[model samples]
Target: MRAYADFVVEYKLTVEFPNFQDKIYVRDGEELARWWIAQTNRPDTIFCANDEAAAGFITEIRRAKFSVLGDIAIIGFDNTEVANLLDFTTIHYPVDQQAENAFLILQNMLHSTDKTLIPLEYTLIERHTT
Candidate 1:
């Protein structure tokens, strides 16, 4: 998640994570939202690790009387179908392509085939949020 923090910094945006004062962890969605709102000073953009976290954040934000993608832009990773249905902007990791590449590699290793294999590709799928 440090890398994600660095990404926000590079983009000239502020980020905040839930406090972790101990080894054991918790996922209190409301607490996380409060911390994030306080730390970012209610910034107009938020980035979450996954769609689930983003969904939680959005719920809290809505409960706080804030409009999603209107007052703030929310983005999550892993282009899940739910994210698409929710019109979320996400990182579209090529999972199918990756599996294909892995299968090709394993097949080549298991059998001496002279067939050429194509590499996997990835692209960002833009949506409602920026």
Candidate 2:
């Protein structure tokens, strides 16, 4: 969340925070949909915490007789299988790479006293939803 806010500030981007955040889960997204519909002024884009939540959000949004991109655009993190299945934009966070990096760092730490860590990043996957 801090990185997101810092990027927004650094880039001088205009983004609204409607306080639509919750636990990372499909059910959380489903529940948040109700609050989203209640708002008179809705944002065009919503960044979900994960693909599962985005999937849930899309499901509920469509169930209410609204188009996914037609009504709103969705961007999820962790670009899991659901992202490709749903054909929505998402941030491809490679957990495997991070895990490998961490393991290497740990192995090095065991051998030597120097224990340095590296940072991982996310890649944006452009799709129909965006």
Candidate 3:
């Protein structure tokens, strides 16, 4: 919350949920729904830590009879498959690629072969819900 407050102050944007301390304890579905209602009423954007929390937030927003991106732009971290299926914009972390690279590196080290070098790569996937 403090980080978000700092970001808001640094950007100088009209933050609707400036009272972050008051909305800090919204953990469950009902509390999340209430917070969504308050935020939607003020038309504030929401930033979530991960896809699960974003999924919960979207669920509550939908339950309250409001659209997800229509009412507020929701941003989430971790480019999970759920995010892709829901067309949610998220930061892409190459989990699979990282695992593959790690496996290859381990295999090379175990075999003690230096014939060729393996390359590591990462790319961002862009979808809807920006």
User: What lDDT does the true structure give each of the candidates?
Assistant: 0.67, 0.83, 0.63
What is the TM-score ranking, best to worst?
2, 1, 3
Tens-digit lDDT string for candidate 1 (51-95): 666666667877888778778887766788767877778777777
**Candidate number achieving the greatest lDDT relative to the actual structure:** 2
lDDT of 2 by residue, 1-130 (tens): 8898899999999876556556589887887676678778887888888889888888888888878888999888888889999899999977987888888788887887565656677799999888
Residue pairs clashing in model 3 are none
Query: What TM-score does candidate 3 get on C-alpha atoms?
Result: 0.55
By lDDT rank, best first, the candidates go: 2, 1, 3
Q: How far in Å is the alpha carbon of 109 misplaced in model 1? A: 8.0
Per-residue lDDT, model 3, residue 60, is: 73
Tens digits of per-residue lDDT for model 3, 1-130: 6786799889997755534233322254335556668653554566666665666666777778977777767765677777777787666666776677777778889998653434544344555554
Q: What pairs collide in candidate 2?
A: none
Better of 1 and 2 by lDDT: 2
Model 3 gets an lDDT of 0.63
Model 3 vs truth, CA RMSD: 6.5
